[model samples]
Target: MSKSTLKKGILQLLIANVLNMIFSIGTNFLLPKYLSVESYSQIKTYQLYITYVAVLHFGYNDGMYLKFGGRSINEVYNEEIQKNISTLKLFQFIMTICSVCVAFGLHDTALLMAAIAILPQNMIAYFKNFYQAIGEFKKYSRIMNMTTGLTFAINLFLIAVIRTDRYQVYLVGYIILSVILWFVLEYSLQRIKEFKPFAFDFSLRELYENVASGILLLLGNFSSQLLTGMNRWFVKGLMDTLAFAQYSFAVSMENFLNVAVTPISVTMYNYFCNHDENKDIIRIRELVIAFATVIVATAFPVKFILEIFLQKYLDSVTVIFLLFAAQIFYIIIKSIYVNLYKARKMQKKYFTKLCIIVIVGFAFNVICYAIYHVKESFALGSLLSAIVWFFLCLIDFKELRYSPRHYVYIFIETIVFLACGILLESIMGGILYITITIILSMLLLPDAMKKIWNTGKVMIIRMRKSKSR
Candidate 1:
């Protein structure tokens, strides 16, 4: 890639993430204040249900990026790719009908309300993946930012206009916004005249072959979700809705923090897929270290911000700490796993490991719940599950060269930060001590600061040289 393209890609990523963060933070602030705890819990439960349904929408869209994205534009716009798109659309339609039927049959009002909005949501997601697969990062970033901002705007308007406490109204607004966004996306796709819609040309035999591979890939992705979100369901079953609500708040906050690294992760997958050689080893190492440092720095301050903003849910502090700690390991594994997926078509092996993670996670949840009460036990379950998944990923992708020493260092740093900050908060106060500690710790990272300064110097030198020429 040219330097201009690289810089533009980075800028697009920054803009997308910033917009997403704004919408997420806005929702976190507004939703809890507007909805009752039980109502918010209901919304969260429905979100979890829709998330599972989304997993079943096939994994070809994800596999498309790794498998086809590195190729030329003509190759990506091939007849086979078009056939896959048509088949995926048909499958999604069938799944939508099935999901609605199941939701209605079970009389799950919350899930049914969520299901009403899921079809359009999945359609937009598929189109976004298509954009990424073709390396149209600018377009993808624009659509994402616009959609996020629009969602927040719609929700805010509904809150003000409807002035109703009924959560179903919120669901209705969600469905309306999703439908409108889908049409806008469809129009946008049509405007790209090169992206012609092809007739369904693939036979069932061809699709079945690909579907088997897709299912394994889908299961691998689903297993990651299970490791991440299984705690919510376990906590809900073992404890009360209020506890689940608190846990959801903490998880949401952590996830919002992850918005910073998401662009890096997505770009890293594309980068490693295209360039897999020892020649890039030094560059990859620097990227990994930079990425890890960014995540750590962003996460530490955000935890304190969460405490300040959502003071009513202070009880979730322990759960939030554990979840954030788990995220460090999870992010490291994800960084390596992307490269592994790119290097080898080991979908079956990946799926097997995921299955193990799900089973182990379930067992941990059961054993913990049996031992202690729900809230505390669920937190332990999440921590243990993360540890197990990280090790399993390490063993499976042994070529990645991630070491126990690296993990040990990360764990020690995180513990020191948390322990000192917590102790000071207890002795002094929460807000003032946390703010001071965050500022001090951030300044201690000289290496990260040095990288930033050197990059700035290079950019300035380049600008001056261009002007002289």
Candidate 2:
């Protein structure tokens, strides 16, 4: 793809993500406002159960992603796309059936909601990847934005107008929305340049091949979820529904902020994979560093404001601080690889990182809960894993170089924020530490900022020229 095309795609996706985050946060606040913590926690519970459906995906989709990640619209043919979709539909069908059985066996409304959502959710996810791969960002953004808007609107209608506190309402709304989105997504897919409708082609051989390629990716994803998603179950055991609600609330905020950064990761995966040499990856890192710097610096104030407005969720304040802090290191680790292993077909190294994260992350979280018996400890445990992943990126991807001092600086900065968070233990303390760190980091990141600005300047010039044409 041309630079302008890539830039446009990134911009569209970013806007969709930002708006989606807002809409999600709105429901998060609305739910807790009208309902009891217990009812709201049910929504959180429903969300967690839905994640299990993702676990069922088992990386079949990711294999498609790793395969098509860097290619442009014309590079791939319709037949191949049809085959990937066939594999996706099969896996999703199997998972949905399993979810249905589990939901009925347990006789739980939340599980049932999950079962209903699995297929539609999986389809929505497929289209998101599909549009991105085919360079259809306009459709990509439109469909996702529509879903985000409808979801929030329907949710508001349910809670505020209907005056109901049943978390089941949101689940029902999502199932309906997901169904609509699947049709909309399919329509959008049909509009792809020179796209043609095809039958449901089946290939047992191809399906097995797709699974073989992506199972490790699946394991990595499933294990990662165990660390983050399983925390709700673990936290509930440690405390009550309200406590889990608070932890879940914090995570909602953390994940919301996380949405905005995703376009960077998404685009970077393709950008690096499209190139053989490390030079391009290094250029991209400058932009990554700049973005991370801004996200880390602003995280505290944003969390503080959300905490103020959503005072009932006050328990989440500390959790937000800790999780967002960890995301700084997470971004660093993410930027380092750019999904190079998957792109390079280095499944061993890719699987290795996934294994280490799953093992170390699970061990730390469980051990932390055993000691402190609180969600705070769980948050700390995740940060510890991020620290480990940072180093793993350095060692595993030996294709690049940066200053050793750069590595040490990352460690010290991470430790300092973590120490401040643990020691002072107040919103004000976090803001203060963030202030100090921002000042210190400014001293270190001027070169990165300069590179980012230069890149942005070129992008803007190209975009303007394209517009003039």
Candidate 3:
């Protein structure tokens, strides 16, 4: 793809991600304050369970994206797409039913209801990914932003007008909106004829093949989730619901900061998958380094902003910082893996290393919590897991003739930037000082500034061209 096209793609991705961040931030800020700490924790837990459901449906969803998405709709026809969709829908339905039954059997009525309510949401997400893979950014962006806005508006109305103490009301509203959006999306796709439903001989052969690989992928993903989320679970166990509520807020802030990197990662994978030229590799590497630099530069100011806005919840700032660091590490590792997976269909080498890191992370978290406590153990586990994943990613990249020096440089820059921010925060005792330090640090990063300029110029050109067209 041309640079202009890539720039446009990134811009759309950025808009979608920004809308997502806004929706998430609005929810996090409003919901917890409206609901009691116990209710907030329950809401968060159910959300996590929903995430686990998504993971369980990973095979079909990923299969759809990889097989049907990478090609034109005509190239991969309605019969194939519909078959995969039906199979996936069936699989997801079965999983959902089984999960609901199990929850009921365990007498966990709250979780069962939450799972049932979130099923439509998950279905909408699958369709969203399909649209995304097909490059229908306009439709996808509209659905995402609108659904998010609707969710936020409903939550606010419930809290403000109805005075509903139950978070389930908000969840029900979310599910209803999701179902409406899904139907709209499906209708829109049908207008194109290519997306029309058609009967095909449904077979599990292809699905089984994909699932075999997906099983390993699923395990890897589950392990990563455990490593990332175990802390929150542990916090809930060790601390009170209020403490978990506080940590969740901080996590939401960190997630908002990292949202900017989402487009870079998505575009990186698509760019690498479609192009194999030597020149393209150079460009990819530059993009990766530039993206990483910008992310590192932006983290400090974003954190500063969060601390200011969430002054009432500043106690979790340190924990949030650690989580932010871990998230950045995750972005780097995932970016490289996206490229690796695209180039080579499937590899067990990185999978093995990921398994090892997960094992080490689990042990580290368990032992540290047993020895020290919740807060310190969580931080220490995140730091250690980052170190382990970093090295493992380095080893994997070397096998692909990729050097780790760029990542090393980015890591060092991040460390220095963070260290300077911490030092300034200690002495200055004001958010303004921290903000200035962050801005200065950003200015000091020449490569990051250049990338920003380049991206801006390309975007401006694209806008002018679109207007002329």
Better of 2 and 3 by lDDT: 2
Which number leads on TM-score?
Answer: 2
Model 2 Cα lDDT, one tens digit per residue, 1-469: 5556557667878877888777867866776667888888888888888776766677666666666776777777877777777667766878788878988999999889889788878777777776655556666667667876787898889877998877777788878988888877666666763344334666777677767777787666666676566556778776888889999887876776556776666665665555556776666665565466457644455456565766777767667767877787777666457366666777677667767777888788889988987778888888788778777777866667766646655656666665665455357756776676566556666666566568789989999999999
* Model 3 Cα lDDT, one tens digit per residue, 235-297: 767877777877776666666655577676555555555665655554455455545544544
Q: Quick one: RMSD of model 3?
A: 3.9
Over 4 Å off, model 3? 1-3, 194-202, 277-279, 296-312, 399-408, 420-451, 457-469
Backbone clash pairs for candidate 2 read none
Model 2 spans with C-alpha error above 4 angstroms: 1-6, 193-199, 415-438, 453-469
- In terms of TM-score, which candidate is stronger, 1 or 3? 1
Per-residue lDDT value at 396 in model 2: 63
Task: Give the per-residue lDDT digits (tens) of candidate 1, residues 159-190.
Answer: 77776667777777777877888778766765
TM-score, one value per model: 0.85, 0.88, 0.84
C-alpha-based local distance difference test score of model 1: 0.66
TM-score of 2: 0.88
TM-score winner, 2 or 3: 2
